[model samples]
Structures are given as structure tokens and as C-alpha cells.
Target: MAQVLEFKLPDLGEGLTEAEIVRWLVAVGDVVAVDQPVVEVETAKAMVEVPCPYGGVVTARYGEEGTELPVGAPLLTVAVGGTGGPGPAPAVEQGAGAAAEPTGTAASAESAVSSEYSGNVLVGYGTAGPAARRRRVRQTAPAATPAPVAAPAPAPAPTRQGPVPVISPLVRKLARDGGLDLRRVRGSGPEGLILRADVELALATARDHREPAPAPVAPAPSVAPAGERVPLRGVRGAVADKLSRSRTEIPDATCWVDADATELMAARAAMNAAGGPKISLLALLARICVHALARFPELNSTVDTAAREIVRLPDVHLGFAAQTPRGLVVPVVKDAGRRTAESLTEEFGRLTEAARQSALTPADLTGGTFTLNNYGVFGVDGSTPIINHPEAAMLGVGRIIPKPWVHRGELAARQVVQLSLTFDHRVCDGGTAGGFLRYVADCVEQPAVLLRTV
Candidate 1:
């Protein structure tokens, strides 16, 4: 007899409370081994492959693709001590398959899987305690009845007055922001689970059916045309939230300078010509930023709001912006101040490739003490960058192009670039910020200035 064991979604680290099912790797009726990846999920931080800890036959799955499930929700169930051999699970069609019939009691399932479980789910998270046995609740559909056309009631009906069956905190926030009561809106998901779609539909229906005000005495105003609507979720939503918080919390100021980068470009060309590994322009810029921070340490610090003190970081964990198919992401290079330009180039290349492939982890994307934004790739001249929250400063690099400039007291065409520095006013005064930017501008104009620091 096989003991049917349930596997709930494990907690992914970095305070992620939920994840959306991106794809299902193992379907129902397939046998799997311990610590094998069974599904791919996308959280706000990154894409993760979740592995099943218990080895057995995958008897059932819970969520469909694109469904957002909260932490601790049932992911799937496996039958341990089954008849199937443990070589490997044969690949099944990648779709949500119907669950297999229950084979054993919950108590039996819990006892059988405890010994075989590996207790590892993600890189930083593990199961500290034994898995709790959950009794599956099956909701039976009520008899069909004719309902209003505008608001068709969902099956199992709405809970008139009880605890709302909501999963995602995002859905709860959505309802709260819209001033809608969850007790009135019906749910369409399993066990009458309240989904974000349900809340959106209920809000739309209410707008369409609201009572019209009394006709104006003179004339009526023309309605504005409806534009396309895009939901703020996933990576986009995370970026929006971070930017909003930065704007609301940080008192930031921007100062910029136009510098002649002709000598810096010439120095890079020389270095790459005689190098074993090709050096990138971004790496040189990062090196300059690192040295500049050493001179003005205040820009490398973060403010402790509760403590009302400046926390200056000893290391320079540098973050550089990279645009990918998913959106804009900043991957950090750990302990960047200790690394040489060659090492920085290699690390930047590795992280950029990972960002492009959507393979970056939360650990790789966080712990950045300072950010370097190169909007020059977009063919822009300058931009006032917003400081990444909690971090004290950011350096924005614009396009380096040929412009007429004084070359040793003579008008000539030179490779020129714009550098902008955005810093938190609360962390340092204008004089400190100005000194840091001036040092960077000097290094950019005269690459030999960095050699002294090196």
C-alpha cells in the first residue's frame, strides 16, 4: 500500500510570501526521486526551481500555470513506498494533470515521508521542524441557479459573514485599496479561494452598475477614452514599489558634470590591447567609483532610520543596472573594492548573462551598498537617477560621444560624457556629495588619477 503524502510550498527566503507557478515539471502519475525539481515558480525576486523532498510517485498537483499561491499552500502530493521503481520519473506532458485518487490516511502519509525527506527546499531555507499533516478540504458545488447577468455568482457561493478565504496578501491589499469588502465578493477558486481576478471583476461590475447622478442642468461633460490597462505584478510591481518608497522616504539631491573621457577611452584601449582578458568600460567606471568612495566614505553609507545614525559600510558591494527581457534588474558584485578591473569585468559579465537568462537568485540581486547606472546605452545625454532606497548614492553615466571641447587650451573634438550623482541629503551634506562627484569626474577625464590610488 502506498502512503499518499502532501507537499506544501516551502518558504523561499528574502521574505517572499508568495510565488506564481511558471511551469509544472512533473505531472500526475509520474514517479520522482528525492530532491528532484518538480516545478518552476516566479517570485518578485527571481525564478526558482522548487524540488520535492520526498521520493515517490507524484499522485497529484495543486495549482495551474500562472496561478499565484501563498506560502504553505499545497503544491502537490506524492505516494511514498509505492510500487514504482526509483530509477527516475519518466517525463510527462508539461501541464496541470488531474490529481490521483487518495490512497491512504493523512496520518499514515505523514509518518511514511518523514524518514525520506531531505528537508532542503531552497538555498537559504530549510524545514526546521517536521512536516505538519493537513486534512484536505473538498468543497462541493451548490445547485445551479439563475443569477444576475452583470455579476454571475461563482460556484460554492460567497461567504456571507465569516472568515474570508483569501490566499495572496496582494489580493487582500487590492481589496482594501478599492474599499471592497471581501465578505461580499464571491470566489471561483478551489475551496472558494479568493483570487485577485475575483476582486477585479467585482470592482468592475460595481462600476458598471452604480447609480447615475441627477442630470446636470446645463450640459454634461464628455467622458475620457479608456486606455490599455496593464496590471502591476511580478518584477514590474517590485520595481514600482521600491521606486515609490525611495521617493517617499529618501531626501535626495542630484548634481552632474560633463567630463572629457578621451584619455579614459585611450587608456582602456591600451589595457585591452595588452591584456589576457578583455576589460570592459563599465568595469573601469566601477573601479573609479570604488576609489572615489574610499576618499569620501560618507556616500558609501546607509541611514538607520530607527537609530537615527549613519551606518558606513566597510565593503563596496557594487550594483550595476542591466536591462533584460523581464525588465530592469541590478545584480551586485560582492566586495567589489577588493577586486581588480579584470575580475570586475568577469563578474559583471557573469551576472549580466544570468540576468538575461532569468537565472539570478535573490542573494545575487541584493546586498548592494551602491549602484552604478549606465543609461548611456540608451543613447541618452543625462538623467537624474533616483537613489536606490537605504543606499546613500548612485552614479549615472550617460552616452560618451565626440563633442567639441578644450584639449589642453585648444578647441578640438574629444570623447565627452556626462556624469550625474544622486545622493541622500540625510546621509551627507552637499559639500561631501560635491567632492565625491568631482573626484569621479577627475578620474574619468584623467585615467592616470586612478593609478595613484591603485
Candidate 2:
């Protein structure tokens, strides 16, 4: 009378329809306790750990790593009674609008109930089974008599799950280019699987190993005039889609201003020299944006195009555009308004590093109320960056250049940088946009404005 229970995939938030399995914490034959982490899942917005709803021995794994499973799919099967002993069958409870069928053994009824409740695995919900039983130890034989018995050797350690598999063609090509062995890597994909990063890591690890150099071979003839061709997919594809949607959906207005950031640059240098990682002008600018959003909450808002309304967020979450080999990604710093300058700088470093390594989760990319793109890093003067929808505004920082300016009626060369602000004209007027840019420029020029505002 062993009781079997099926654990289905849980629904992650934000209306996620599917998830890729990043890893499985337990395997068949392993006994797991209720509320123990059983798997890691990657939804469109974040990577989250899922706990077992019921405690028991895992009997079967339903989904393989790297498989993109829709919500409500079965993930694993667990058997609930002690090993080698039959347990009482499970009871089935019928809900409203259902007809009763012929009664059967509790086991059969339990199976039917599990199948019926297969869909709708929401987070924090319990699994479809009876409560877990407490563990018990077997009694040992009496010590009294006989010949001493030799102890058996311990069993070998079980193999860990391998890299998640990559199903996308673009991901596969990238993995191949990195010379990765997919079988050895575990995916952080929808199902317990391998993804592109797993392959990249494998290649990186392989490169670290030293070996005798291979003999030189003649170069093969060119198949076609050799020119680099990068596929517009994954991050690149996402960027294209986001930008296009922002342009088409948001009524954008661009405003430009010149900021004299001499004091701000000095403060940044001092902060970096005082036991902090090197802080860039871009970072200081981001800090100013955070402060500005606090003073003017409306700037930190989004437009619900479908709902035909403007939604103003209560807190500021800043998104910084980071360029990776895959494409442009905007990893966000949540609750930017609550962070100190030093903490913000640290977070910026962490997010940038994670993005470069392709290890950022969905949570790092969403919930941004405003965005900043540093075109200055590329030596550009200034250009309007498209808003990251449904956010209503974005800021672009340009290169600092020595330009002629009048100081006390005398002309002199001074360091100046151009700032571009793009806002949703539907929600923000040109006057509001200009005021916001001016406030930012004033802060950059003085640097003390931030101290006052903070």
C-alpha cells in the first residue's frame, strides 16, 4: 500500500507561463523532507528555489533539465511510506461541480486525485499528498553472543546532475563556439537543464588546462569572404523588441542640456580613493537620478498601454544599460532611493559583473522605474536613448570634453558634458522634462545639491 504523490511545477509570479529548470537538488531514491529545496527554476524574470511540498522518497523524475515546461506540468513522483512497507491508501476529496465515481482502493483514488489536481501549482501551496511521517531507526540485534561481523564498506557518492541542455539554435551555436561539452554542464534553463552560460563556463575551464601545443596545420581556404556575422537573438533580440515597442507605444520627447560636472568628478575621485572601487562619472550621474526621482516621484513611472493609463511607482528602481557579448542588457538596482552612495556603487559593480558573466537572473532585469545609458563610454557627445518600456523616462550621458565658455565675462576652456533626457510625452510635458534635466545638471555642476537633497 505504498502511497505515490506527484509534485507539479509551481507558478512563479508576474504571470509567468513557463520556466526552465536550472538544477535538481534531489534524485530518485533520495528521501526529502517537506519544505526542503527540491529544484531551482528560471522564469522570464527571476531564478527561484522551489521547496518540496511533501516529504518522501523520490521515485521518479518527470522532467529533464533544459526542458521548457509550461505551468502545471508534473515534475517528480514521490513515495510516502517507509521503505519496503505498504502504507494505507490516500483518500480523494471531490470539489463542487463534479460527479462521484465508483469507490476504489485509497491508492487508486489518490492517483486519480493527483491527476485531477495536476494543474495550478502556485507558489507556497502544499503538494497533493498526506503530511510527512517522522523518521524512525531500526533496532539492533542483541550484543551478547556470537562471532564479530565485519563492517561493510560505505557506498560511493552519487553523481551530481550535469549541465542543463540548450535547445535554442542560437544558444547551441554560442555553446559550440565556446567549445563546451553540454553533457557536463547543468542548465539554469526552464527545466533542470543546461544553458549558454554553462557551455561558456566549460570552455573557460577547459582553456585553463595546460597541454602540449598541437602541430601547426595549413589554413583552409575561405568558404566565403570572412566577415563576422553575429546572430540577432537572445539578448540582442530582446533589446530590439523592447526598443521597437518603446518607440511605437510611448510618445517620447527628447530634451538636452549641458552639465558642468567638475565638482561631481572631484567627489567621485575622492570616494574611489577612500577605499572604494573606482567610481565612474556615470555612477555619480546615476546617484543624482535616484535623488531626482525621490524629489519628483512622477518621473519614476510607467505607462500601461493596454490599460491606457499612467502608473506612478512609489519607489525608484534604476536600470543601467550594460553591454555584454550577447547584447545590450539593462540590469536593475531595486529601491535605488533607499541605497547610500557607497551601497549603490557596490550594487552597480555587482550587477555589471553579473551581466558580463551572463549570470543575471530575471529579477535583476525587471521592476526598473527609470533607466540610464552611458553613450559617453563610447566617446559620443549625446544621443536620445529610447525609453525602456513601460518606464516613462531614460537618461543618456555624453563624453566630457574641453569646450570654450565665458567665465566672469572672460572666455576660457572648461570641461562640459551633454545630457540627453527622453520622456514619455503622453505622461510628461516638455516643461517637466526640461525641469528634470536642469535639476540633474545643477546637481552635477555643484555636487553639494545631492548632499542637500539626501
Candidate 3:
């Protein structure tokens, strides 16, 4: 007999609780190899494929595309070691709960189960790798005469079971709030799983059966237009929540200054012109930030609100803001204090490309000691952007443009840029913050100032 094994959604790291189904690679009756990606899911952090651990025929899938499932919910079932080619074609049986998922044969699947099972669920630990082209296994129907079409039978009333198959708490809460019995609601999801829609339909039916209420009086019409409503979910939602929390918790202050970045620009140009790999201006700014943080470590620390402590971090994990099609994301460069400008340029390019492609892993996005917002790329002068939460400070760089300046006691057009520092007020006073900003501005004005420390 083919042993059917249920695979629940594995715990994706970094405290993620749920993921939305984006696409399915394997269907019912399709053959899946061990550690092959069976589905693509979008979490708050990134899009990743969930691979199956067993090599067998897929018996059923739990959710449809766009359905959000909790971390420990059953994703699918596979029949291992069945005595048939692939599995039975999809069939809808009365009281089967779901209408489309297929059944499997016992003997052939059993042999397949033993040979192909790897028991590895995550990407890096086992056979799971980066998302690649799915190797589709075509499922063919059994050779049999088809029955004539007839009127569909009415759905049977749901019978009370040992336990309800609802996975999401939101679905349970909806059913509870609506005063609907979950046992009476027939599930349309796989394996007789009670979905939110089922609970909603039951509630709607109950309302329809009740006596109609009297019509309410009309209210005065307003001239205001209902504007577009976009849901803040996934990346956008995460950003909004983090920024809100940062603003609500941290008492922050901003200090800004205009610096003649002519020398910094010249130094970068010289380095790039004579080097094998080009150096980016952002890298130079990051270098300046790192050096400044070294001189004044308070700006590089985060205030532990729970402990009522100011914890200074030893190594700099520099996060630079990058705007993508999804929204704004900050990808952190690890050990930035130890990296050269060329290395920083390379890592920034890698992370920025990953962010643009929506391929950044959770590890690439977290553990930042400080943030660098180069809003200059947006063609703006200056902005006091909100600090990324848990981190004490952010350094904002504005556009470097040619302007009239006194250089070497003569009036000339110099490349001038505005640099702003926003720090948590609890961590340091204005003097420490100003000293850090002054050091950064001095580096921009005279690149030689960085050499003495470097």
C-alpha cells in the first residue's frame, strides 16, 4: 500500500508566520522528485519556493493560488510507493470535501517513496536550491469510457467531525464573530478544510433566511470622492509598520549641513579611473559613515528599550535604501567597517540587483547597525527620512550639484552636497550627533581627512 504523507508548510526563518501562495508547480497525480520545488510562496520578506521532501505521486494540494496559509498548515499530501504509473486522474467524489485533488495507486508509489525520499525541506540544508525552471511531470487520465452529463447533485450537509480542519485563525475568528457553526459549513478547500469564504457564505445564507429589516432613512449626500484604496500588505505593509513603530517609540532629531563635495568626487573619479573596478559615490559615503561611526560610536548603536540601555555594536552592518517596483527596501551589507570602497561597491551592486529582482533573502535585509539613505538618486536636495526601527541613526545624502563656492580663497563653482544625520535623541545629545555629522562633512570637503583615520 502507498503510504500517504502530509507535508505542512515549513518554518521560514526570521519569525515569519505565514505565506501567500503565488503558484503551484506540481498538481494532483503529478510525480514529484525529492527536494523538488512544488510551490512558490510570497512572505513579507521575499518570494521563495517550498520544496517537497518525498519523491512520489501528489495526492492532493491544500490551498489555491493567492490563498494565505499559516506556517504549520498542511500544504499537500503525497502517496509514496504506489503500484501504478504516476497516480489516478483527478476525480470528484461525494463527501470527499475537495472537488479536484486526485487519488493514488498503492504499489508503484511505495517503491518510489523509498528511493527518492530525502527528508529535507529547507533550501540550503538539503536538495533545495535557488528557484529554477520547474520540471513538469505530465499526468494522463486512465483509459475508460466517460459517463453521460447529468444535472449536478446538491451538496451534502456537512457532518460533525472529530475536529474542524480550519487552519487560519482569521477564518476561525470570522466564523465565531458571525455566530456560524463551523461544523455545518461545507469546506471548498482541499481535504475538507474550512476556509473564510465557506464561513462567509454560511453567514450570508443565514442572513438571507432571516426576516427583512425596515429600510433606513437616507443621509445627506457629501461632495467628497472616494479615493483609490490600495492594501498595504507584504513589503509595503512591513515598511509602514516599521516606520510607524520607529516614529512612535524613538525620540529623534535631525541635523544637516552643506559640504563642498568637489574633493570627494575628485577622489572617487581618480580611484575609478586608475582601478580595475569602479567605485560608487554611495560606497564613498558609506565609507565616510563607517569612519565617523568609529570616532563617535554612539551613532552606531541601538537603544535597547526593554533593558533601558544604549548598546553599541562592534561591527557595522550598513543598510542602504533601495527603491524597487515592490517598494522601498534596505539591503544590509555585513561587516561594512572592514570593507574597502571597491568591496562596498560590489556588495551594494549585488544587493541592489537582488532587491530590484525581488530576490533578496531575509538575512540580506536584517541586522543593520546603521542606515544610509542616498535620496540623491531621486534628484532631490535633502530629506529627513525616518530612522529604520531598532537602529539609532540614519545618514541621508542629497544631490551633488555645481554651485558658487569659495574654494582656496576664490569664488568658484564647486560640487556641493547636503548631508543630514537623524539620530535617536535618547542615545546621545546634540553635541555627539553634531560631531559625527561634522566629521562626515569634513571628509566630503577634504577626502584627506578620511586617509588619516583609514
Q: Report the number of the highest-TM-score candidate.
A: 3
* Model 2 CA lDDT for position 378: 87
Model 2 misplaced stretches (Cα beyond 4 Å): 1-4, 22-39, 54-59, 79-244, 257-260, 272-283, 291-298, 304-315, 322-335, 346-366, 375-383, 398-418, 449-454
TM-score to native of every candidate shown: 0.75, 0.55, 0.77
Off by over 4 Å in 3: 1-6, 26-31, 56-64, 74-96, 99-216, 219-227
Model 2 per-residue lDDT at 324: 77
Output the TM-score of candidate 3: 0.77
For model 1 the local lDDT of residue 305 reads 89
Model 3 poorest 10 in a row by lDDT: 144-153
Q: lDDT of all predictions, in order shown? A: 0.77, 0.66, 0.77
RMSD of candidate 3 to the true fold? 6.4
lDDT assessment of candidate 1: 0.77
lDDT of 2 by residue, 14-95 (tens): 5555667766666655666766667666555534556766666665554566555555445665666554432322332221
Report residue 79 deviation for candidate 3 (angstroms): 5.7
